[model samples]
Structures are given as C-alpha cells and as structure tokens.
Target: MRPISTDLDQALALLQAGELVGIPTETVYGLAADASRPDAVAKIFAMKGRPADHPVIVHIAGRQQLADWAQDIPDAAWKLADAFWPGSLTLILRRKPHVPDAVTGGQDTVGLRAPAHPLTHALLERFGGGLAAPSANQFGHVSPTTAGHVYNEFGDALGLILDGGPCTVGVESTIVGLTDAHPTLLRPGGIPAEAIEAVLGVKLIHHEKPTTAKLRVSGLLDSHYAPRTPLLVGPLAALEAEAYQRFEAGQRVALLHHSQMLQAVCGAECHAMPLNAESYARALYATLREHDGDRFDVLLLEQPPQTAAWLAVNDRVKRAASGWLA
Candidate 1:
C-alpha cells in the first residue's frame, strides 16, 4: 500500500520527477502528473487504463496562467473562469503549442481548471506548472472522493496519496466546451448549468447527441462512476418492494433513500441520504463507496428530483445505476 501524506512538498517532488500523485480537489481526488511532460502524462493513461483520446483536465494555480496552457481563449471563457474558476468548472479551449499531445489526448483542444481545494491549489502554485489530472480510479469506475478510495483503487501502484480528507463537492468538475461557436456543456457536475448561464448572461448549449469525431472530454462515458455491486434507481415504493423480495430470497440487499418516513426494513441494510441537491452531491460518492464495500447483492437508490439543481447528482446516479438496469 502507498503512504498517505499531508506533505505537499513530497507530492511536488514526485510530480516533478514525472510520477503520479493522488491529489484532492473540491470535487474528487485526481491522479495528477506533469501536464507539460508527455511521458508523465502517458503514465496517467496507463494507470487509469484511460483511452489515449479521452482528454484529462489540466489544473492550474489560477486564471493568470490560463494563457500559458491554452490558446485563443474566448471572452465567454474568461467570464466563466471569473465566475467558476477556483471551483469545479473546466473550460475546454484550444491547446497551446507547448502543451503535450498526450495531455490533450492528441487533440488541439485542452481542458483547463483552477481547483478550489487549498492543498491542490497550493501544490499547483508551488509546482509552478500545469498538472494533468483525471479522477483517481480505474477508467469508467466510481470516482474517489476520499484518499482511502484512492488507496482502495490503486494500492501501492500510485506513488503518493495526498490525504486532504473528504471532497466537498464529491463529484467531478463541470466541463464546458468553448471551442465551438456556442458554449456547450460537455458534462454536468459540481456547478449547475443554470448557475453558469446566470454568470454568462447567456444560455449554454447542452450536448445531446453522441459523436466520436470531435474533441473528447472526461466523465462523458455512458456507464461511468459505477460500483462493482449492481445498482438500481427508482421510486422508494418500487425499490422497497424489490429489496424485500431479494432479501426473502436470502440475498443481502442495500437500499439508499432520501425519504424521512421510510424506516429500515427488516431484511436489508438501509441508509438514508440527504434530500437537498447540494448535501446529496457531497454524500453521493461516499455513500456509494461505503455500500460498495458491504458486498451487497444489489444496491437500490431512490431517484432524485429531476430539476436543474439535481442535474449533476442525477447524472451520476443514472450512470451508476445503468450497469444493473435491464
């Protein structure tokens, strides 16, 4: 097993030596490497088994260094950065000449963000360069929101794990593609679409169709953030019925619900999740990670409200539950 540390200098040393470090952000923990080094960047792909063309986001210290990594950043990009940077929004822009193709996944476009996590931000400032990072887990697996999750995923394979505690947002960054004529939401996450639009004073375009020809960003996979245990999402009544049936069959079942009136059933392990979107987002991954460890035969999640605020959490739960949906 790898050592978990609060030392940023040790992490910087490993990163400078072209090694991988598990670093925490407000959203999720990332497997970070030097973005400027192709060899270092390639290690991230190998470690996560990520496709070469699936782009990772490059984390910078602040918006001041944006021009150093990306080229031709638009006015809209600046506004979004002003509103959402140092938080969980990632801006997709044209890559600079020096950014490695490995970092951009052989595309001319690069994903950039300034994370709000104090340790990661301090690390970026001290490292003095961009760190190409994706969620610290196997490709298409449940993203890690804690350092222990990172250790659980890779064990000793990762050189260092920066123990920054539980992630506040507990999901990946919201990715917005700005290279196109209209700003498009590549992925929904920590920040909501309405919030971004409110800041820009313009409605953002939502990418509805799936295509393989253009610049690809992270967290767009159809069956991502899934746990090893099969999961299903539906109404509380339906889930409770199914859980009882499964339990009667002598199978261990886990049910996650947001309802306060719902009492723990006799046969299955029950966990109540937060009702609000923000609180729910913070607990989503950690709840999944916890239940995943119990070796339950099936996990049932009560579907959340289908509102703009619940978009990000709903996206994650939908993907997580997709594996078991027949």
Candidate 2:
C-alpha cells in the first residue's frame, strides 16, 4: 500500500465523514474517529477487532475541553493533568452520559487524553468533539509505535495515516481513574506510579487487570499489547535455559535481557538495556517488536527489574507473555 500525507483538514474530513484515520500521539499512533459518532467508533472496533468491552480514549487538544468529556475530576487529577497533559497520560473520569456508550464500551466512565503530538493537536483543535482512538493495530496485538507498524497491520484497509514519526514513549499513556475519591491506576504508561503518588500525597491503588467483567480500554485487557511472536517471561537463567532448549529443537529465538543476563548466548538474537526502570520502560516494546518477525520463533524475555518504576513496564511484559488465548 502506498502512503499518503495527511493534514488537519483532510483528517477532519475523514472523521466528520465517519471514516477512521490514523492520528499521531507522543505515546503511540491512534486510529481516530469522532467519538460521538458511534458508527465511526464501532468501525474502530471492527477494524482493530478490539472487544467492545475495552473502551476507547477520547483525545482532546488541551485541558480546558476535558470538562466536555469527564466529570468530578479530583483535585489530585487536576494536578496530574497540569503536570502531564499535552504529553503521555490518560485520565479516566465519569462520563457526561450523552457521551456515546460505544466510546465507553457501555460503561459509566470514559478515558480521555490531550495528546502532545502537534499533528493530533492540530486535528483535534480544528475538529473538536471527543476523538475515540486506540492504538492502530489489531486488538491484543503489538501497538503501532511507528506508521509502518500501522501500515503493516492494517495495510490498504486503512485510508489515511498521519505519520508524525515514531512515538517517543513507545507505549500507551498511564491511565488513572479519579472519579472515585482516591486516584487509582487503570493502566500504566509514560507516567510513573510514584509521580502520581507524589502529587496526590497518597499512594494510588493499582487495580489488577480486569478479566471477570469486560475491559474498558486497550491496556486494561489482561492479554493485550502483545507481539506476533510468542513471549516467555522468567529470570535470565530460566530464559537462557528455555532459549537453549528451543534452539535445540531448531526454533529461532530472541533474547530480552535486563543487563544481568549473559552478554552472549548462542542461537539467540540478544537485546539488552539498563536495569533502571525509566530507561527500560521506554525501550521495552520497540525492542521486542524489532525482533518480532517471521525469522524468530519465540521471544524469550528476561525478568524485569523488581522496582516500583518498572511496575507498569513489568505488567505489560507479563501480559504480553500471557498470550491472547487466556
């Protein structure tokens, strides 16, 4: 499929016409549509094959418009918003009711974000109404950190892709719901759990990934944010042993290391990064996706750092290993 450059007008036209368009964000690329247009929102689910239960995030240009989508935002939320908005962070708040149920997956809450990418802000500012978008990839698949990822996943099926280059954070926003009195983490992303706690003056509870009931957003799915290749999560020694065994069986392998892992392992395509959480989280998915291809049989990922900063990154890695079957 050939690529076509998109501008604000073209993006607005596609969205107003109820067609899906790719919008850029600092965290990742979003398959965007007018949130109020249930037909357009439904198309997002159909195109991505995302479960209706996993809600879409409404992207706004700035903080002032947040009131149009959410309600009863805690003061702590306001603080975090000021600190992180126009960047990577999503706030889950009480929906205004009239907000389309499709955007919330029939839930009372909505996930809203003000993306930092200039291209998305231009589109949202010009065509203002909540834009319900998720990462532009099949549901439960590896997210599109670059436009090529989207092109590879959806191909000619999609019409326009607004490529603002690779997402800097290389993951989704950290989603925190403040509708309740205390702020709780709905999902973790570019924002660290500690940063939120620092502002709230209290620890925010991180909920276990919801499985019994339908999920409300992309990252909340227990088995989502996965790469095409199978992932195995365990200690470096364990991963090395497993990779050796898999290699013995004639399977190609990719080894994910946390610095402590052996520098060189045979029959393994090795990737390494710092044990520090911030650096590790930023590098996680792109590293995995880089090695995820037809050439590799299994992605053997070493255990993540045992620290609070790595919490969200660890969660995603473990979930990626869980696979879509569970």
Against the true structure, whose lDDT is highest?
1
In candidate 2 the C-alpha lDDT for residue 302 amounts to 72
Clashing pairs in 2: 55-216, 55-217
Structure candidate 1, residue pairs in collision:
none
lDDT of 2 at 81: 79
Q: How do the residues 240-268 of candidate 2 rate in per-residue lDDT, one tens digit apiece?
A: 87878888999999887866653578798
lDDT of 2 at 92: 81
lDDT of 1 by residue, 223-305 (tens): 88998888898888888888889999999999888986446776888888998999999999889889886689889888988
TM-score of each: 0.95, 0.92
Each candidate's clash count: 0, 2
RMSD of 1: 1.8
